[model samples]
Structures are given as structure tokens and as C-alpha cells.
Target: MEVRMLPEPHTVESYRRSVLGLVTALPAETVGLAEGLGRTTAEAVTAAFAVPRFDNAAMDGYAVRAADLEGASPESPAVLVRLEPSRAGSPQPRPLRTGEARPVMTGAPLPPGADLVVPVERTTSGRFDDGATVALWRDAKPHIRNRGEDIAEGAPIVRRGVVLGPRDLGLLAATGHTVVRVHRAPRVALVVTGDELFSDAGPRAGIPDSNSVYLRAAVTALGGDVVSVQLVRDDEDALRRVLDSAARKADLIVSTGGVGPGTHDLAGRLAAASPDGTLARVAMRPGRPQAHGRWRGTPWLALPGTPAAAFVSFEAFVRPVLARLAGALTGGEPASETVSVGWPGRAGAVRFVPLAVEADADAIAVHPLGSPDHASHSLSAMFRAPLIAMVGAETANVETGQLVPVFEPA
Candidate 1:
């Protein structure tokens, strides 16, 4: 296979667009609520009823009439006829008439005609003594909670395409949604190719083939519903057979390694396996070399094999493709975030750099990954890198402190 090169390197935006354009061909799907986290919402979910479903008290106190409290103060206190036993979630025994007070518990409904709630501490305490009577002071504004105060029954609770987080889950549950409808996680197939790679550590010279494992985890983290990860030697026949077969069961096909120029590079061929226009090599750096089209009608990305290189490419390219497949908005749309450069930078073409960010009241600062050499010896700075600093080729030289747009995480 001939490695295709462009006269001017492709921009990061160009590559992101390339990947997303391909994935969008595949439409969104619906999945169950049990596994909806990280997936996007296909449709809007409005509340079935009010959040509280009824008026409820904000604090524990006695429900009373404000009229009786007129002229009542520290010097002189207003007295009321104390109604018996009010508990939370229970309806009032009877409506209180003017000048009557109800002993209401926290969260209990206020009696009719009662206009105020006086906490026990705020009011004078009364007790049942021998043949007893008590002096209970009642003075305060209406503490009643009106119906539909918390939330209206038909209010728009959650919108479409919003990624469901833990808090979103609680909101759904509160809305009486035991099962939710969300965009299904796209299923993926990961194939890593390398004759030199090893998966065991028996005093072996080669490390375990981690790119596939990493790719698998990355796919899951990006809202992949189902994934198939496997190793393939640098043989065209073996790779072709496995990838083509996996494509049938998955919506996306991801291959690491064999994307670069070498005697064994097989990324393009695998992507081109299908009759559809699914494979094409793009020009760029590190992960610039890619092939996408379709195998068994499923969108696919053939990624480079370099661990760090493959990772950078995936975040820049592959992940976005997955998002598009799952109906996520990305790449300079209303959903993307912007930031200021924290380091000097430049890219011969579009470049995706590992980034760390610190936010302040005014703006956010971007810390590009130290040079590749800096990352190998110290993995701490590179692992779980959350930012994608997108720099274009037109940037002659990027100086520190310049504002730049960043690809926000999934």
C-alpha cells in the first residue's frame, strides 16, 4: 500500500470533521436506563408529575394563623389553641379556623386557614401538666408550601442529547422514571496488529500488547455499549478475516497499529475490506494516517500502533467518531470549550496535544504534554490526560498565554 501524503498537512479540524462525517452515517440508538451513563439522550424527558408531588414544609414547626400573632412580641406574646399531633406526610386531621394553631411536624401538610409556622424555639413552649394547660406562643409568616411549588407536572425536566451523570440519574428517579430512554452506547471492535507485541510478563523482553486493552477501555469510557478486543499478527489474511467478521456485530471498528508506513502496515486494507467507500488514508502527524469507510455497513477507524501516538490520534479522531455515532455534538459546535495556551506550541499540520488545565474566575489555562521524550520516563503526566489542545498548521509559532480552542472531554 502507498502512503498518501498531502501537499499541506490536514488541519486538526479537518481530521475531526473527516471522522465525524463518517460516523454520522450511522444513526443513534436507544438503550436501557440501567446502562445509560456516558450515553447521550435521544429524546427529551419531561416530568410525569411535580417533583414533590405535593406541598411540603421546609422545616419542623407548628402551623398557625398569623392574625393571632398581631401585636405579639418579646414583651407580650400571642397565644393560640394548640391542635394535637401532626406528623410528616400525613394529611391534617382537620382544618384550623382563624386563631387556631396546629402541632405540625416537619414535612406535614399545613391545616386550612393556618397562615404561619412558628418553630418550637421561636415560640413559647407549652405542656400538659396536672389537669393541665400550656402557654404556646404562635407568631410568624405563612410557612405553607403551595402545590406544584417544587416543580410543575409538565415542566421540561431533562433535555435531549445530555450525557447522563450520577446527578442526572437522581433527577430521573425523582421524576418517577425507573427506566429511561437514552442514546445507546455504540458497540465497537478493537483489533491491534503487531508481530513484536507480547501479552505476558514471564521475564519477557516485550511488554503485553496494551494498545488493544487501552483502546478497549477508552471505547468503554467513551460510551461504547459492547466491545470486541483482540490481537492480530502482522499478516494480511488473518487481519482481514477477523476484522471483516467483527464488523458484522459492531457499529464501529477500531484497529491500532499498521497505520504507519512499514512493510506490515495493514490499516488501510482492513478498512477497505468492505465494498462501501469506508477506507481512505488522511495526511497528518502521529495519528494523521487513518482509513475509514465501512465494513459490514459499520463505520470504522484504522488507527496507528504507537501507544502514545495511537492514544493522541484516538482522542483527536476516533473518540469524536464514536461520539457522532452516539449523537454527541463536538468540534467547534456550541458544545466545545475554549482556553488559553499555557505553553509555547506549533504544529506542521493540525496537532492534538495532551493537556492539563487549571481554571480560574477569568479563564482556563492549558498545559500541553511535555515532549514525547518527557512522557516515556514519567508516565504520571501523560496517563489519563483529559484535555485535547487543538493547534492548527497556520500557527507559525504558538507563544505561551495565547487563547486557543480545546476539544472538551466526552
Candidate 2:
């Protein structure tokens, strides 16, 4: 077997495109409004009706003509003819002449001739007592709720390629769309490499294969269904056969482990079994051994064996491709942030240190991975933190307050 090495290391932008084009052509699915949350909209949606549907009152005040309070003063007030109380959803409020006023509540439709709403606080409380109108305490401007002021009928409520969040669901419901068409979630197969990797409770020896479940959950968060997570040893033949079967069954193939430079080269053979597989070197420390390629038009994301490496590679590369393939916007790298940290500066490659983060006026601090043996015990505690200070290539040494890129953990 011929095994080759890459001459140079690759950055996030280097192979970003290689994996995105792998599986961009998938079918879309139509789901109901209840299930559309978090799904990407396939087509642009237009509003069938205006946002308010009618001119409604913003306050519980009296509706009157804009010119009704002309010459009304605090000491010598103008008392207009009063009418019955008009609440919200009232179709017809009694029209008012130049000196006429009516009692109106909040959200009530303005009458045909009513052009202004004077708040009750600005007028006497006894406005509707004994067939007489209250005197104006103070003059108020016209407070009319204009039709289509929020959104016009047939307006574009949501554009195509927008991921539906909670706000989007309300907007769609307001636009009278009970159902929406979204990009269907592609079924995926998570192939865990390394004979030393054990993920299930049935195992007692090798390290627990946490990467399988982690990667599976990551894919799920991006709207992909990891229907099966299969673990394979460093055996090349077994991996090839499994990958071939996966290409036939799964729409996406994500393999974690066995992409590093070592004797056990399972990812390379699995790549060859693919229709047109390729491998590249990632520059970062944790996920530097990451490899990317394709299998029968389906993309193959080959991550490193280390837990941290696999996660960084997936966050740096794989998840973006999956989001785009699912019709979500993902043309760029992960949301990078500037943070501060100190490193030994001996290791050559760029390293990603996962730590708990808190915001201060100056910069973020790098927390110790928190007792390597008990990291899982306090994972949630670390997650509350938001920043991970990054060290660059030219950096040989770092200080406590130096600003660096603070990466967000998924």
C-alpha cells in the first residue's frame, strides 16, 4: 500500500469548499407548521394579509377627530358631545363632528370619521357621565393606527434559505401559513474508528467512544439525523466494506478517528472505497489530522481519534457543510472571537484550548481543562463560559491579558 503525506498544513478556508460541494443536491420535504421550527425554509414566503389586519387602538383612549379639540384649553376647556364606550374589535365607532368626542378602549378600530385618539388621562374622568362630555385637561395629538403600517398585504414576510426560529414561526402564523416547505434532514451514519474506542456501557477496557455520540448530536443539532453510529477497528478491509455499505444507505457519512499519521490507516482506505476521496492536512492542533473527501457523491468527514481533535474538526469544518447541504446559510467558518491566553509556545501547530469563560472589562481568561479525570463531571459548568482564547502561528509566547480569538463551543 502507498501512503503519502501532505507537504503543508491547511487552514479553515483551505478545504471549506471541498466538502460543501460534496452533497448539495438533496430533495426537500414539506412539513406542518408545528414541525417547521428550526427547519430551513426552501422558498420565499409572502404575507397574505397585513400584520395588524386593521387599524387598531394602541391605547384605551377616546377616539375623536383631529380638529375636535381646537381652542380647548386647561382653564377654559372644550367639552365635546360624548358617546358610548367602544372596545377592541368594534366595527363602527360613532363618527364625530368638529367638536364631538367618543369613549374608545385599547385596540378598538377607529370610526370612519374618527382621526385621533386622546388618552383618558389627558381628560376628565367623568367624560361619559349624565349625557355630558368631560372637559379636556390637556390637548393631545392625533394617535391613529394606520392600515398596513406594520406590513402590507402580499409583502415578503420571510426570504428563502432562512432558518425558522421561534420568531419566524410567529411571523409565519401571522401570515396565515399553516404549513411550510423545508429542506429535509438527510440521514447520516457516524462511523467511529479505532479499536481502542468504546462508546457503549457494554465495554470496560478501551476508552469510551464519546466521539460517536458527540458527533451524532452535533449532526442532529444541524438538522441531520444520525440514524446509526457504528464503531470499527483500525482494520482497513472492515472499514472499506462498512463505508461502501454506508454510501448505499446513508445520505451522509461521518467517520471519527484514524486520520492521523500512523501505522493504523483506516480512514485512507475508506476514502479510496469512496467514488472520489481526497485528504488534506488541517492546521489546528486538536484537529490537525482531520481529512475530508467524498463517497459516491456523499461527503465523508474523517476526524482525528482524539476527543478534542474530533470535536474541533467537526465544528471547524463538517458542521458548516452539513448546514449548507440542509439549505441553511453556512458559507463561512465558525463564529470566531478574539480572546486572551498564555501558552508554552513550544508546540508548533495552532492549538485550541477548551475552557470555562466569563466576561470582564479587559479580556477572557483560560480555565484549566478542570482536572482531566473529572472533565465530564463539570462539563455544564464550563459550557456556561463563552470564550476560548486562541494563540496564532507567529505567537511564540502569550500573556494573561493578550487579546486572541475566542471560539464558541457548540
- Candidate that scores best on lDDT: 2
TM-scores vs. true structure, each candidate: 0.83, 0.82
Residue 330, model 2: Cα distance from true site in angstroms: 3.5
Off by over 4 Å in 1: 1-9, 24-34, 126-140, 205-207, 273-283, 329-347, 356-368, 372-381, 384-386, 407-410
| Residue lDDT tens for model 2, 9-31 | 76655666666767683577888
lDDT of each residue in 270-364, candidate 1, tens digit only: 56554443334444444666666676677777777767667767777787677777766643342233445444444465555557778799977
* Residue 35 C-alpha lDDT in model 2: 94
lDDT of 2: 0.70
